[model samples]
Target: MEAKELEAEILRLVREMAPHLLDLLGVGPITAAQVLVSWSHPGRFRSEAAFASFAGVSPIPASSGLTNRHRINRSGYRQLNRALHTVTLIRTRLDPATKIYVARRMAEGKTSRDAQRCLKRTICRQIFKILEPPNRTRAASLTDHANQLDAI
Candidate 1:
């Protein structure tokens, strides 16, 4: 079929660009390609948080009264968010580490949706690290920089 052929071509291209993305538990070739396209260049994002915000995986504070909770961000690149959501869904069902993480979060009183949001944020961070060029500042340094900015 033509669709199968196209998918194969896409997989080949994605493999040439960032094969490691496919090694990730929930990422298929299409999802990898989507990530590659969206994260077009190194240094495009100042920090992993910035990348996460762009992907709409950043948590927004929604705590009120006695409940401390965060909500999913409703802005940014929806296509990318959908890709991440697809990855999150796959991982939640099939990835052992992700299962453990979700269980741990649930044990800590987070709802299923909250656990998934956390996982998406974590995945965004991982993808950012992999996509970042080696010459750029690593996430720890970026986090420190963000912290310093927060202090100012």
Candidate 2:
């Protein structure tokens, strides 16, 4: 298939899999697909922090002297990281909320790079929440159904 056709197919697949993810600011079909590929399954990540770590968006301590600072993590799944970076770039340029967040971070003394890192971390958390499996276990669902039967 042609590139445009392939992108269209991806869009269709993404819509079927997780249409809600596309609602997030700056998340296009390509980026959403990358996320799904990296995530692989609902329970792949134990927590948002784990997903952030996988994406290399979790900050690593790089404190020096009395500075008490962190640095951008330079390792993890590079393709996922690149996908996140692309979303971050698009948001920074076009998303009003992201622009305000970055400005606020800058006003608080963080460098532009630092602000972007923070945004990426936030985005990672957001994506994790959207993609994570529902917390209700099978037993919980069964219990709920039992309760409903009793009520009926």
Candidate 3:
């Protein structure tokens, strides 16, 4: 298999798997596929911390003999960072809450990068919230109700 042919094969497999992946995530196939693509790349994040660093959201600690400072980790996957940044930018434009949050951070004297990092963190939180599992206990209650009806 030539490199180009291998690449094509991988892409075909990804397309086939995308819908199932979306279904598992409980999201529309297109949206889930888009998220997967954004997070997928060679040499991309290997863990959440790495992804956080890549998104320029990880705080870098600096401490030296009574003087301490924190800064953004300026290393890791630039592509992922850029993707998160694009999302943040779009959110800022469309979401008034996000815009206000950014503005408030800026008013608090945060640098532009710092403000952006804040926005990125906010976006990450939202993403995680969407991807988190819902309560299964509620489903169990419905099942219990159905069982009672069956018993009657």
Candidate 4:
């Protein structure tokens, strides 16, 4: 299928499963699907470290005798980083808690870029949680049913 066609299908499925979530967020399923597809590549990152690396949020450590410094990791999916940064900015603007969190980070001496990175990491984790299959929970229930059958 074409890109637009696939996106439409994803939107349709999302609408079926979560009509209210989309409505509450003021976004159609197409927009949500686009964001999910941007972050949902399989075999991409196995751990948070890998995800942070891929998102360009992981800090690079630099140290010498009696001196140490950390720099932002810039080598990663620039598109993914841009997407996450954009989401962070939008979330901070719309979510009061996120705005306060950003302010607190700044008060703690974090630069604007550093605070944005922190926001991006939080957004990335939320995206990860949303994309994971709900079937995993149902699978656990199915396993319990099988155990009951064995007990019988």
In candidate 3, where is summed lDDT lowest over 10 consecutive residues?
Answer: 21-30
**How well is each residue in 1-152 modelled by candidate 4, as lDDT tens digits?**
59888878877877765454354232446556545455554333455667777778777776688856456678887777776666676677787888898999899877887788777777666655555433345456556767889999
lDDT of 3 by residue, 24-101 (tens): 222333344455566553233344455566555787887689966567767765655665666767667777877798
Q: What are the runs in model 4 whose C-alpha is more than 4 Å off?
A: 1-10, 13-35, 38-44, 62-69, 133-152
Model 2 lDDT per residue over 11-45, tens place = 99999999999999889999999999999866566
| Predicted model with the maximum lDDT | 1
Q: Clashes in model 4: which pairs?
A: none
lDDT of each: 0.90, 0.89, 0.59, 0.66
Better of 1 and 3 by TM-score: 1
Clashing pairs in 1: none
Model 4, position 61: C-alpha lDDT score: 79
RMSD of each: 7.5, 5.6, 10.7, 6.9
Give all TM-scores, in the order shown: 0.86, 0.86, 0.52, 0.61
Residue-level lDDT of model 1, residues 27-144, one tens digit each, is: 9989999998899866678889999999998999999999888998999899899999999999989889889999999999998888999999999988987888665765655676
Which candidate, 1 or 4, has the higher TM-score? Answer: 1
**Model 4: how far residue 120 lies from native, Å:** 0.6
